[model samples]
Target: MQVNKRPYGYEEQTMFAIMAQILLIGFGLVNTGWTQTDFFPEETQLKTAFTNTPIEVCGRVVDQNGFPIENCIVCLTCGVATSTRADGTFILSNAIRSNQLLTVTALGFYPEIIPVELYLPTNRLAVELPPIILWPSNGNVIRFLFGGDTAFARRMLDPLERAARNEFPIENPDALISVSNPLPGTLRVVSYVKPFFLYVDYPIINFESVVTLDPSTPHWEKDYVYFTLPGSLPAIKTLNIDYVGLGNNHVYDYLESG
Candidate 1:
């Protein structure tokens, strides 16, 4: 290593130094031996030697039926918060050995908190937490209807119309929803969704655009994307969509406008 470095020019040495500094700065924002960041809290206040320890605090979240819960928010009282992936898996690497509480919350289910002790060693340890089950909080059991990605689906109108007529059940639903689409056009195809949106208690959708007028530059992203006309949101307001989660890849499609 010394022999190779001896032949390197000043530019190469300078680049390595900059990279090293960047790495330290990156880690500093999360956790370090001296200070703790809000998003990555440590339990102990001890000033230990600087460690490059790769600790793992991993866990899964599920419903009472043992089915996995997606998009659950898991937060530790120590400061860090992580969301479970589609399969209900999450890992908190900056976890310090602490005797504190870990809170788990989801949209429809009741929130739960569990006691935790996250300890770190010289070597890496995969500390897996227990499966957190979220039961329904409200006594009134609700039936929810869900639909998939509607970005390019101009054919979604018929089903949405059925859902609105209650012909899908003729029975009123507790909640009916669609996800991850921004209303850009006149929406002649899915105007049926408006009625279902107005009827349900939790009128929710995953909005994936800046939801504005005055068109912005096309996103350089190499994936499927869409932006809603600001005028289109009036349709949303008419439907009374109560909640939105920016959990899709294209939420950043408009860059700063996003």
Candidate 2:
């Protein structure tokens, strides 16, 4: 066999390539701070897993100072009542058996009672009652709203399947109930894989049925519609418009598909 040795230039080139890859990886890790946390347990036990239950009971609470009270005690049948946080909110759910009386009590404010109905899951109640009128003057009603995961992109929203893309794609819980509460226009969003919470004061809904004449198009079976901007924009001679709010859930989906 003849003795042979590779050129020093090739060896130096290979070493330099390996060092460059190592430096790039280190720079990436340093620039981008990412952490991994366990959201779901590895071993899901039937006892620990929550069986899907329809959320029925809902409500809110307010103090004498007219401030939303959070984490006050909400109870049924002298059972364990959930505490309200500083927002003066609580909920009693139908996960427990029905035909129970919901009682709410706090330190300085008077306690209120709510009767549980047989149709508990879909029913809404008001547990927080206003202080009884000692004098005869009407009061202003405070308004609040709640819901989440609503696709509120101000554009033509396409189907979700057209949204998810591979590589370099941009991407984007508890309660108790009260009866006769003051939550007008409040919406509760059901959580799926991506959980979200929303509380809107004035929800102006402009939802329309998706219109299509063809059956073989990309967005064939999905219901979608377009939203118009409030006012017309004056044309500029040397400017182009960029969809600034496209980072939202719906627009991001459309962009991914496009």
> How many clashes show up per model?
2, 28
Local accuracy by lDDT, each model:
0.57, 0.37
lDDT of 1 by residue, 145-213 (tens): 343332322122222334322112122222122222334333543564554454345656766554443
Structural RMSD, model 1? 20.2
Residue 141 displacement (Å), model 2:
21
Q: What is candidate 2's lDDT per residue for 1-258, written digit by digit as tens?
A: 997997679889999988887797777843435575656665444323333333334556765456666556777663646776666656555434345565666654445555554333333332333321111112343222222332322222222323422222112101111112212101221111111112112322212221122212234333542222211111110112222222233332222233
Over 4 Å off, model 1 = 1-47, 50-54, 140-258
Best by lDDT: 1
Where is model 2 more than 4 Å wrong at Cα?
Answer: 1-56, 78-80, 118-258
- Cα deviation of 198 in candidate 2 (Å)? 38
Please report, as a residue range, the 10-residue window in candidate 2 with the lowest summed lDDT: 230-239
TM-score of every candidate relative to the true structure: 0.34, 0.25
Best by TM-score: 1
- Model 2 TM-score is 0.25
- In model 2, the Cα lDDT at residue 145 comes to 29
